[model samples]
Target: MTDKMLKFVKIGQQTPPKRDVGDRKDDFNEIYDDFIKQKAEEQSSRCSQCGVPFCQVHCPLSNNIPDWLKLTAEGRLKEAYELSQSTNNMPEVCGRICPQDRLCEGNCVIEQSGHGTVTIGSMEKYITDNAWEKGWVKPIEVKFEKDQSVGVIGAGPAGLAAAEQLRKNGYKITVYDRYDRAGGLLIYGIPNFKLEKYVVERRTKLLKDGGIEFVHNFEVGKDATLDQLRKKT
Candidate 1:
């Protein structure tokens, strides 16, 4: 009956076990280990469940932070992931790259009151990654059938997100990218220290599996002018 959130006082703060500086420096792999289930639960329980929830307020995507933290603490991972995905187009990616020290965790009420901020980003990542590993993650459902098709001009995060959303709503989506591969900026701009190329590749594969079309090495200006594509599509 006492199962609830706000256990920070009893639990203390913990980050994932980081690899040694020397070892991490020499490798391109992710430096922080994934939080084990017990550690993830403990960290999630540290949320103060603030009514105002500045953590959620500060998050650009306005994720329901307290809600998912409570779910994770209650060992309800599926619910946590669902709530997280409701607001974020890419929860796991944001969990890995978002500067939490300057955003959500920085605004946590308990952190202002002296306790270390709850490991919100790590907990978010854990919820989603565990969801995937457990087979809870599945292809997004088609909401409805639409005749009109949508053409997205890029394969970066924003364009990919738009394409996925359109496809989910039953619109045929075609993504055109100048690069030979999908994930324009995620592959070219971000280094492996922060994000791995395979993560982006897996997401692109998911989109392909869901009936979204991607045209790589196709240039809008060089290959076909805007007027040409508009006339074609």
Candidate 2:
């Protein structure tokens, strides 16, 4: 297992290509081009497969970074995607927004020893993107319908993720948001350079497709009392 990894001595660090500064200033788009199959595999191969993976521990989400990296290196992209998605409700979103320089990649063992980190974030995105393209991503399927219904308070990542998990366990979930659109911060706050609105929209659509109901422009306090809402739920 370790043999397939630890190619850092043979391969230098490489990340997804970024648009030039001049082009970047012209419009709002993702700054970095995605890593192609070969480049992603090559970068993933740089992982040391250390006895202890600091990358996972340092991740706020505690993603199985090294395991997915090894799976990517071995060309097992589907397995890599499954492992990557196992720990994250929104792996693609985290892969884009999480500051890897301050977390997973920052704590990589090989990176501390002078070999550049394995480009973990880029690889994470690539795995999931590949999964989507291959139709490996599936709809939410509840085990059994629950007698109880739950109301979520926001439409941001936290609320969306919560709704997904709750729905999977057969709870009827209704997300209420203040804005006209769902995705509270994602739709209105973050700039497109770092995170695109369409990416967030695609996810919102998926949640709707998966049966998570959303009530936008809904002010809980003004529209209905917390106690009233609680009773309805």
Give the winner by TM-score. Answer: 2
lDDT scores for all predictions? Answer: 0.87, 0.88
RMSD of each: 1.4, 1.1
- Cα RMSD for candidate 2? 1.1
In Å, residue 86's CA in model 2 sits off its true spot by: 0.9
Local accuracy of candidate 1 as per-residue lDDT tens digits, 33-141: 8999888888888887887999999998899999999888888889999999888767888888899999999999989999989988888878888887897767666
- The segments of candidate 1 whose C-alpha lies over 4 angstroms from its true place after superposition are 1-3
lDDT of 1 at 232: 65
Residue 191, candidate 2: Cα error in Å is 0.5
Q: How many clashing pairs per prediction, in order?
A: 0, 0
Clashing pairs in 1: none
